[model samples]
Target: MAKAMTIPDYHPYQQAHLNKPQLQFSDIAPLIEHYQVQPWLTVTELGRSVKQQPIYQLQLGQGDKRILAWSQMHGDESTATAALFDLLNYLQAPEQAAWREQLFAEITLYIIPMLNPDGAAKHSRVNAQGIDINRDALALQSPEGQLLMAAAKQIKPHFAFNLHDQNRFHAAGPYPNPATISLLAPAYNAEREINASRRAAMQLIAHVQPWLEQQIPQHIGRYADDWSARSFGDTFAAMGISTVLVESGAYRGDDNRQMARWLNFQLYVAWLAAIASDSYQQADVALYNAIPFNRSGGMKDVLLQGLTVSIGDTTATVDLAINLALTGDRRARIDELGDLSLFSAFHQFSVQGLAFKAGQAYPLNTALSLDTEAHLALLQQGYTHFSGDKALLQASSRLPVLLNPLRPTQGSPQLWQGATFLLVNTQGKVVQAVLNGQLISVPSGVIHNPLGT
Candidate 1:
C-alpha cells in the first residue's frame, strides 16, 4: 500500500525543523496511505466517530513481540501525533529502510495515529461524545474506546504506549515552568503490584532514560504511579499489558511546543530502537526516582499593581493577577490572554513594593494593610493596580490563605473586571477585549496562529 522512502541516520530535530506544522487529521491521511505497503503491512478502519470520520489503524511488523501505540487520546495533545508521523517518514526513507525492514521482520507494530480524530480537528480534550477516551478505557462507553479495546484484545501486544500532552504549569522542581516532560510506567491494581508486565514497561522507560537525559537533563520526571481504574494505562497494565504512558508536555521558552515536539520524536525513536534491541536484563529502576521534580518559576503575563479600587464600600489599593497561556514568544502571545480572577490565597509575587517588600506574598483573604513605601515600589516597577469592580478568581480551595472573607472566583475561565474576556491581536503587543470598555486595536501577521498570535 504505502511506499517506504529512503532516509539516512535521520536526526529527529533536523526532520522536525523541516516538518513542524500545525497538523490536522487530513494532512496525515496521504502519509498513512503511502505507508500501507506489503502483505504484512496492512491498514484498516478501526471505526468512525459520531461525525462519521474514519478512525484508521496501521499495522507493520509481525513478530513475537508486538507494540501497540496510539496518539491524540486528548484531541488537543498533538505532539505525540507529530512524533508518530515523523517516525513513519523516517522509516520510509531510503537510508532508514533497513531499520524498518529489520524491525518488522520480528515484531508487529499497531499504530492508531490520532485516535480522537474529531477532537484532533477541534483541538479539544474530549472526544466527539464529550467523554475522555483515556477514562473510557474501562467504561468502553464511547465508540473510540470500544475500538481501541477491541483492537488491543485481538492483537494483545506485549507492550503499549499511552501518549499525551500535559499542561505547562508542571515544573521540573518547584521553580521552573514548562515541565520538560514526564513518563509513567503505570501501576496496576489497588496495591500497584509490579508484575512481569510492569517490569517490562519499566525496562522500556529505563532504556529511553539515557537518550532523554542526554538531550534534556535535569528535566524529565516519573509521573505519580497511583493506579486509576478509569485510566487507560492503568487498566491496560492491570490487564497484563505493559503500558508505558508517555506525556509530551511543555518546554521553557518554546511555548508553541515545538521543542517538546522535537524531544518527543527523539524519545520515540530511541524507544523503538531499544525495544528492537531486546536488552532489558540490566534496567536500573533506582534511576526512576532520580528524575528531577518540576519547579514553578513565578511568571505573570500582566501585573496590575497599586490601584485604589472600591471593594464594596471601602476604597483600598488592590493588586490584580492575570495568568496567561504561555505560547509562541516568551513575552505574550495574543491567544495567551485570559480573564483575571480574584485570588485570595498567599501568592508569591516578585514583590518590590505596595505595603509589601520584594519577595513578600500576601494572602488576599483579609483586608488590605496599605503601606505607602510598598505602594511606591509597585509604581516604580510600572505596575498599575487593576481598575474596575469585577474580580476574576483562580484560587484553588487547597491553596493556603490567611483570610477567607476576601476570597475571589475559582475554576477555569473565571471572569474579572478589566480582564479581557476575548484575546485580540494588539498588533504585536498583547491586547485585550473590552480595553478601556471598548474594542481596541486590530489583528495583523500570522493567521490561524496555533501558539496564539
Candidate 2:
C-alpha cells in the first residue's frame, strides 16, 4: 500500500496580500504586474469583459499533468481569488522552494485570477451584461464563459477546480455551526453517474476532508450532487476531466470573511501538496459519501421560549425564533413564533411561565433628534419602547427599541419594531424585557403596563 500522506501546516505561509475579502481587479493590479515579471510565470490576456476589462491567465510549470483553476467566476465571490494569490505567494517563498520545485516538476497550473472583472468591481454575482457566467457554460453567451470553455478545451487539463462562495446561512449537516467551507465532486450527467474522473475527484475530496475537519470540526459541508449541464463543474466532468468545487462559506463572527479566506488559502496549499505527492490516488473515495451534506433552516441566531404572549386577547405560551436579515442593517427578524423545540439557536433565552407585556411607547421629539444619551435616559426612566416618524427613526440612534412593525408575508415573517416586550412573573414583578429582539434590563413597576398606559 502507498504511504499515507500528511498535509503540511501552511498557516505560517499565509501573507497579508489581501486586506479585505472584497477584491476588485484593480486591487490585484500590482500583484498581477509583479507576477508578470517572474520568470516562472507566463501571463496572457485571454479575453476582455463586457465592460472592456482585461481578463488575464497566469501559466506556470511545464509538466505534462495540467491543472486549471479559476477564481471570481461570480464577481461577488472573492475568497478563492485571495487564496489563489496567497498560494502563488507561498510558491515563491524561500522556505517552500523545495516543495514548490517538486510541485512544478509534477504539474503545470493555469489560473484565471478574476474571470468576471466587471462583476467583481461592482460586487455583484453576474457580469456587466447581467449574465451568470457559470450558468452560461452551455450557451457560451458571455465572453468570459467563452474564454473559460475555450481555455479548458485547448489545455485539456487533467484536473479543474471550480471555486465559489456559498450563502452565509448554510450549516454543516444538522449542526448549528456555520459551514466554513464546502466541497463537491460534480456529477457528469443528468443521472448523476460517477465515472473514473468523478471517482478521482471524490478521492481527492476525501483526502482533504480530514485536514479541514481538524481545523473546523463538524463545520465542513459537502455540496449536493445534483448535476447541471450549465454549470462548469458538471460540464468539465462530462468532458472527462476531474473537477473539484470549493465553496467558501461563513464562519462565526467573521462578517468580513477574513477567516474563511485564510481557510481557503490553507485548503489550496494542502490540496496542491497532495497532488504533487500523488497521494490522492490512494485516498479512499468511499469516504466521500460519509461526509456531511450542507443543510439549511436548522438554526437561528436567537430563540426565546416558554413565554405567555397576549396578542389582542389571544393569549398562549409560545416560543420565538429569530434570525438576522441578510441585507442592510442586519436587523433581527422573527422566523417563527410557535413550537420551536426542533430548532437550535446560537443564543437561547427561556422564560417559562412568564407573562409577556408590551411596553409603553414614548414618542420622539421632532425638534430634538434621538441620540445615545436620550435613548439611554428613556430606558432608565422605565420606558422600554419608542416610536417616531420614519426620518426620525432612521437617524443614527443607540436606542434599544423597535422602530417599526413588519407584517408577515407569503415567504417571510414581518420584522417589527417599536413593540418592546417585558416578561413578568405572577407577582407582577418584572423579570426580563426584549427590545428590538435584544435583551435589556427592565426596571421595577414596568411589568403591569401591558396596554402601554
Candidate 3:
C-alpha cells in the first residue's frame, strides 16, 4: 500500500521540490507575505471565491506592454500556481534580477495567483458551486468567473496568460511520444483564422518554444485552437486580449504534477524574455502549425483480454481495460471510454483500458508483455477477493485507447462486448450458481432445481 503522505511544513526553495512535496493552501500564505514585503510588488484583492477566500492579483513592473497571467482557475491544476511563485522567487536572485528587472520594467504584469481559491482549497477543478469556471466565461454567473472578468476589465492587459493542465495520456508530438510541456496560442472564434490576437499569442509561444525545445526537445506541443463559447481563452482572444493557453500537461509517473511546475517556471522565464525583447513578433506564425497534436497512446495503465459479464440479468461482454489508480478528488467522465465514474466502498469502478471492437477504431498492432505465470499468480491472488454477484476479468498486453467524448456512452461500451464471467448467488444453489450466460461451465455439485421443486 502506498503510504499516506505527510508533506513538509515548509520548503525554502519551493520550486526545487515541487514533485517531491505535497503542496497545500497554507504553503501559499508565506508566499503572499514575501510578495507583500517586496517594494515593487502591488498585491490587489480583486474579489473573493465562492468559499469567501480572497483572490489576489500580484502586479509587478510599470511598463507599457501590460501583460496578465493567472493560475489555478481549475483548482485541482496547481502546478502553474507553484510555477508562478517559483518564477517570482527566481527573479529575486541577484544573478537573474537584472534581466528580470528589465523584463518587468518593459512589461507591466498582472497575475491572479489562484483564480479559484475555493476549488484550490478542496483540490477540485470546479469552484465552490461546482461550476467549471472555464466554461463560465460567457455566463459569468459564478462569483469566481465574475471576479476574473472584473480583473480583466480593470487591467485591460494586452497579453493574457490563460494557464491550465491536461491529462497524462496526451503525447507531446503524437502516438507513442510524450510532451513534457504543451502550449496553445488559441485562435479566436470558430473559424481558426490567424488574426492579430492569435498572431500575438503565437509569436510569444514561438519565442518560448525554442528555449523549451532546447531544454526538453521534441516534447513541446501546440494545442488545438478549437473555439468554444465558454472557453476563456477563445473569449479573451475574441476580446482582442492576445491570450496564450498554457496547458501543464502530462509527465510520466508524476501524478502530482511537479514536473509540470518546473517546466512552468522555465516557460514563464522564457516568456518574460520574449515579452521584454519583442523578438518573436517578426517570426512566422506558421511555426505554430509544426507542433504535433498530443495523442492518447502509450499512456494507459492496464489492458485486458476478452471479458464477458452480466449487468443484473442482461449479459454484457467486452474487452475490459483499466487504468491504474488516478488520484484526484473530483469526478470527470472517461469521455474516451464511455464509463461513468462509479464509486464503491473498497474500490472505485473506473475502467482504464481502451475499449474497442474488432474491425473498429480500437488500438491495433500494439501488444502488452506480461509473464504468464506471474500474471496468473496475481490473478489467482486477486480472485480470493472476488465476492461479488458477477465478475469478468481478462488480461492482455495492449495499451488502452479511449474514444473521445464525441460518441454516446452506449456506443462507448460496445467495444467491450465479448468478455466472459462467472455468476455467483447467495441462495441455496451455491455450486450451481457458477454458470455462464450460455449455460457453460456447470459445476458438478450444482443441480438445476426449479423453484417449485
Q: Which predicted model would earn the best TM-score?
A: 2
State each model's CA lDDT, in order.
0.59, 0.76, 0.59
Q: How good is model 2 by TM-score?
A: 0.84
lDDT by residue (tens digit), candidate 2, 1-453: 111233255555555656565789988888889888998889998989999999999998777788999999999898888888878887888877787778888889999989999999998999999999999989999999999999999999989999998877677887878788889999999899888999989988888777677778988899899989899999999999999999898776566676777777776766676777777888888778877998866566667789776666677888877665544455555667789887766566787888766555667667446665555555555455555665655435443545544431212123443224566778766666655556654443232212111
Scored by lDDT, model 2 comes in at 0.76
Task: Give Cα distance to truth, residue 369, candidate 2, Å.
Answer: 7.3
Candidate 3 Cα outliers beyond 4 Å, as residue runs? 1-24, 296-298, 304-320, 328-453
The sequence of per-residue lDDT tens digits that candidate 1 reaches over residues 236-348 is 89889988888776654455566676676666666666677676536776655566654433233344444223334654444445544343312221122222233211122
- Positional deviation of 188 in candidate 3, in angstroms? 1.7
**What are the RMSD figures for all models against the true structure?**
12.1, 5.5, 13.4
